[model samples]
Target: MELYFLGTNAGVPSLQRNVTSIALRLLEERRSLWLFDCGEGTQHQILKSPLKLSKLEKVFITHMHGDHVFGLPGLLSSRGAQGVTAPLAIYGPPGIKSFIETSLTISQSRVPYTMDIIEHTGGVIFEDKYFRVEAAGLDHRADSYGYRVVEKDLPGSLDPKRLEAYGLKPGPQYGKLKRGESVELGDGSWIHPADVLLAPKKGRVVTILGDTRPCPGVEVLAKDADVLVHEATFMEDLAELAHEYYHSTAKQAAEAAVRGGVKSLFLTHFSSRYKDVEHLQPLLQEAKEVFEHTRLAEDFGLYPVQRST
Candidate 1:
């Protein structure tokens, strides 16, 4: 799994930062991509990356804020111009349908692929055989939400040596054994799959919080997550302003990550007040006081998992 930051600014776009969009690339046996929060100038961010518009299988909007969703219409229209024929599904807070409809209607944009709009009330919004998505209503100026994206538990690894020890040669019958069924060999001995398979590997969880203040939604949604993408809209010195604006500070974001039991914390949605993001490190270090593995995000940077060395 890979997380590519399209934009890392909050409230407004900066010369160095676009609004807010992150691409979750599942580049493995099953190739798919998921996006969180398409902020302003997000389309321009996509242009700079090696991402395909057609591969955008799902988009989860954190809120209806202008900076969070103003780029949707343009991206949707460009999806067709770029020849994306795959169906797209969008999940967001109330009024998302109207927002998309009005944008398309006013601009007279036509997309060849189907667009599924689901205005959620905060719960398990989507699920499939391979993945599950849940949402939580967040404390924001408007109706906002956060999403937890979890991939399905992987199948158990098959032990070929055990099969060979059982005098079973590789063939179509081995396929049956892999499915946890008894396969009859020429000697009439039954082979059990469980005897030669390892336990299933746990799936990774990635939680992305929309613009909001410190709340329980993030703790609940991001419980034991492998990666958490939370918004840190301000520095610790601006705590009062962050709360007043329904945004979070670097300190608060880290605390939430600790409470959520997240393995790694990625802080984004930085305020444009400071030209250098490095200035926020001292504030983020405050969060490390609560959670050790915290990182301040940068635009166009990719954060991939670093497994055991």
Candidate 2:
């Protein structure tokens, strides 16, 4: 899977950064794309990327902030115009439904596809054969949330040569063995899959949090994640200011990632005041002091999420 950052700035847009929006490209995993937050100009950001609007299947909003959801109406309407007939699902806090409905109504936009709005209450929001999504309430100015995406373990590779050695040709029996089921041969001998198949590959976990201060349950949600995407709206010196504004500093985000035992930490949601690239050096340095694997995210940057060895 791959994460594409549409906008990485906090509160407002700047020359180098926009607001807050991220697109998780799951085309190889699920043949669809999932969006997190839809900050203003997010659709315009997507237009500059390789992502297709028709491939969008679901959107998860963190809060009702204007920077987090102002681009929803335009993206939804554009999806309809692109002839995406599949149903679209959106998960967010309570006010999300009203915001979307009112915006669509006021604009008189006609979407040809059915939209499913789920107001989650800090629990497992979605699950399927391939992946599962869990949500938790964050400590933000509004009812913000954090999402954890867990991919299910994939089956081990099957050896055709080994199967052929047992007088078994490639057929349904191979399928059964690949699924961890024992198969009976004509000689009344049972062949176990574990003896020949490779070990099952464990899935990866990704945790992304919305605008929030240092909050509880972040460690639980981000524990052992392959990557933790946290917001660092300020530097270490302005930590008190960040807390007062219900945001987090780079040091605090790094501390959470270290406590959560995540493999890598990606910091986003930068304040507009740090417009110069050099101005963000302090934030990166402070975060790296705590967690060496931490990196700052840039607008329109693509980050690949891979399973740990």
Candidate 3:
């Protein structure tokens, strides 16, 4: 799994950054892509990357902010134009469904695919064989939310050498063992999966939060996450302003990452005032002081989510 930051600026687009949109690429795992937000010019950003709109399977909108959702209609229309007919699923807070429906209707854009809009409150919103997505309310000017994506634990691999030592050749028995089932041999002896299989690999957790101040929902969604993508829309000097606007400072984001016990933190949604890397360096330094494993998210940056050992 990987996260592709299409736009990382807050509020409005700047020459250095666009807005807030992230693509969670699950190509290797599921051969599809999940978009976190679709800010204005997000489609243009995708054009500059290696991503394809046809692979977009799901979209999770964090809030109704213009920067977070202005490009949804255009993206959907473009997907149809590209001959993609796969069903799409969208999950967001209340009013998201109405917003999407209204935009599409008013624009007279007809997407040649079924779209499922799920206006979730808080709690587990989606669950399938491979992953589960949970949502929690966040403290923002609008009714924003955060998502906790939990991947299911994968089954351990079978020990070929160990099975060979048992006088068993690779066959259907290996499949059973891999599935944690015991297999009986011709000699009436049984071999348990634990005897021939390695330990099951733990799944990863990724927390993606919308614009917000430090809140209880942040802790709930970020707890023990392998990667926490939090909004850092202000610097420490503007902590009071950040709180007033229901936005987080870089320092606050890193502190939250520490409190949530996340393995790594990616600070995004930067304020436009930080025009260039020179200005942005201080934000990264502030976050690093609080959490050593913090990274500043940049536009078009692709971050791989490595499997936990």
Candidate 4:
């Protein structure tokens, strides 16, 4: 899996960065794309990337802020023009449904595909054979949320050479053995899978938070995450201002990532005050002071979500 940052600025669009929008590319995992937020001008941002609007299977809104959701109507309408007939599901806090419906209604826009708007209140919002998504309320000014995307563990790889050494040739039985199934031989002896199979490979966990300050929910939602994507709306020096605005500072975001034991920390949602890379370097340095693996996100940058071996 990979994370594509379409926009990373906070509140408003800057010349260098746009508002909040992140795409989790699951082409290899599930053949779909999951959007984290649909900030203003998000559709335009997507157009500049390799992501396909037709592959957008789901959208998870963190809050009802205009900067985070103003692009929903345009995106949905454009998806219709792209001839996306597959069903789409959107999950978010309350009022998200009303916002989408009202926007589409006012514009008289019609999407060709069916859409399901789910108002979630925490816990598991979606689960399938390959993955599960859990949501938790965050400490933001509004009813913002954080999402935990957990990929399910997969069966261990089967050693075909080992099977051959055991007088068993590779065939349909090998497939069954890889699935942890027992097979009976002509001699009526059962071949157990545990004798040849390795331990199951653990899946990767990623946590992405909305606009939030320092809170207990942050730690709980991002525990042991492979990658923790948190908002750093201010520098370490302006921590008080960050708290006043119900946002997190770069230092605070690093602290949370360290506390959660995440392997990597991605600091995003930067304030427009930092106009250029030179201005944003201090924020990245501040976060790296606390967490060595911390990195600052830029618009259109793609990050790989590495799995823990």
Error of 1 at 289 (Å): 2.4
Please provide, for model 4 over 1-309, each residue's C-alpha lDDT reduced to its tens digit, 9 standing for 90 to 100. 999999999999999999999999999998999999999999999999999998999999999998899999999999998888999999999999999999999999989899999998899999999999999988888999999999999888876666776788878998898878998988898888986677788999999999998998899899999999999999988988999999999999999988999999999999999997789999999999999999988899999998798
**Where is model 2 more than 4 Å wrong at Cα?**
159-172, 180-188
Best by lDDT: 3
Look at candidate 3 and tell me the lDDT of residue 182.
96
Tens digit of lDDT per residue, candidate 3, span 79-145?
Answer: 9999999999999989999998999999899889999999988999999989999999999999999
What is candidate 1's lDDT per residue for 211-266, written digit by digit as tens? 88988887888898888888888878889999999999888988888888789999
User: In model 3, how large is the Cα lDDT of residue 207?
Assistant: 94
Models sorted by lDDT, best on top: 3, 4, 2, 1
Clashing pairs in 1: none
lDDT by residue (tens digit), candidate 2, 258-290: 999999999999999899568888999999999
**Pairs with backbone N, CA or C atoms under 3 Å apart (clashes), candidate 4:** none
Task: Give the runs in model 4 whose Cα sits over 4 Å from its true position.
Answer: none
Show model 3 residue runs off by greater than 4 Å. 180-182
At residue 79, give the lDDT of candidate 3: 94
RMSD of 4: 1.2
**Which lDDT values do the candidates have, in the order given?**
0.85, 0.92, 0.94, 0.93
Candidate 3 local Cα displacement, residue 59, angstroms: 0.4
Clashing pairs in 3: none
